[model samples]
Target: MAETILALEGATKRFGGVPAVRAMDLTVERGTITGFLGPNGAGKTTSLRMSLGIILPDEGRARLFGKAPNARTLDRVGFLPEERGIYKKMVAEDAVTFFGRLKGMPAGKARQRAGEMLERVGLGDARKKKIKEMSKGMAQKVQIAAALVHDPEFIILDEPFSGLDPVNQKVLESMIRAENQAGKTILFSTHVMEHAERLCDRIVLIAKGRKVFDGTVNEALGTVPRRVLIETGEGPDAAPVLAAHGAVTDDGMTGEGTHRYTLDLAPGSDAQDALKALVDAGVRLARFEPVRAHLHEAFVHLVESAEREPA
Candidate 1:
């Protein structure tokens, strides 16, 4: 069995008599990338803080490496909080080296690793530049380098992708995959689903201070019905054939003499069977493909469903 790196059992926290995170349970396996996902104000940060022992949980337990969080355990962990902070007056390399030293590294070794990490993150040219002199994206990369310089066994990041442009986001994604390949366990929180979809081996979803879903990506997508996009030359005639299998939404006839329809496959309906049925009906198919359910769709559905449930 794989080792459990982090575990939260019935973990709960509140601020000023209001629950920030309620009875949350989560476990991250070693060498896996786990995404702690939820929208803003969904208790993701609260839960993470509790797990890190930054804030004491009001109930239940939070454990790191089979023991309660402490300085020794934390030394083996690297964290990038949701709120970004660095010494604005400090040079980029100095800032990273400082973080490493705080995690108990000697100054010379910390500075050496800082240089290597900066180069890896594409900030080699900016190493001697002050944090205030760098652009937002460049500064963000510096902060990430700081978190990773120590090469901790487990890395936790809270909303690391926020405020980054598409290009920088992709850069960070590559960095994350590199870390995982190095055999470090990673857990990150994000409101954006695309990052989790692409990076997470497992996902934990929370909403309204509670966990709504926790499972593999494929399992989460399985909660919603499957859909297929089909384009055929049979125009209106294609409607009846698709409707016979499942609810069909007309995407309208294209200018190229092709009719498009989106079919929400009914329970027990297979995409292959639907395609075969269309072909059997003599519909000249131009395109037939499954529309895979995305993490965003699954998240929204789960949150909305939880909201509708009785107290």
Candidate 2:
């Protein structure tokens, strides 16, 4: 049995009697990275806020460390809200130290930890830099350092990658992996599927304020049809053999005499088997590629399915 770090039972919230999150259930286990994923206005932020006791759920409950959230329990958690809150006038180190002190660290220890955190986040030279003086990416990193300065047992980052350039996004991803490797449990909410697909051990997807799926990345991928791209001579038409494999569609010609086709592998069928069938049919091959389903595709597929369901 896994040790659960956080659990939500029918956790729900509303604004002006309009539900933003409805009967959402979630569990984040110890020492694992969980992704709380959804599109904009899908209630991810609402759910996270409710989980941390920052906002009360209209109905249902939230538990942290097997008990109702309280100051002592919250002390063991570090959080970065989706909205940035660092003070523009404060120096980078001072901001981080301030957060550490708020978490109960002594002044001396908090200052020391702040220095270490700033250095760890690549802001050693920026320790004295004011938040207003740093680039958006640098300021974001400073906030991240502040969140970790307390060295909490669990960390919740709400859209940590939002607004970061591609390079900085990769940097944040690496930092996340490093922290998880240090045995800290993490739960991050993101509308971006690429980040979750690469970093999560398990993912919980929300749409329209309700959870629609909960599983590993592979399981999520399985929700959509497996796709493969095949290329061959225009003759013999790979369609005949591919039709038996799954849904086949022409992908347009690639060159003067070569054509491309897409195949959605049938249930329990293998791509290799389909390729073999194409070869056995004497189809001249130019290119044969297996296209793996991305988490974005799975996210879209699941959300659309939920929409189709009669509410």
In lDDT terms, how accurate is model 1? 0.92
The residue ranges of model 2 lying beyond 4 angstroms of the native Cα positions read none
- Writing each residue's lDDT as its tens digit, candidate 1 over 145-173 gives 99999999999999998778898899899
lDDT, each prediction:
0.92, 0.92
Lowest-sum lDDT 10-residue window in model 2? 251-260
Which lDDT value does model 1 have at 166? 95
Deviation in Å, model 2, residue 109 alpha carbon: 0.8
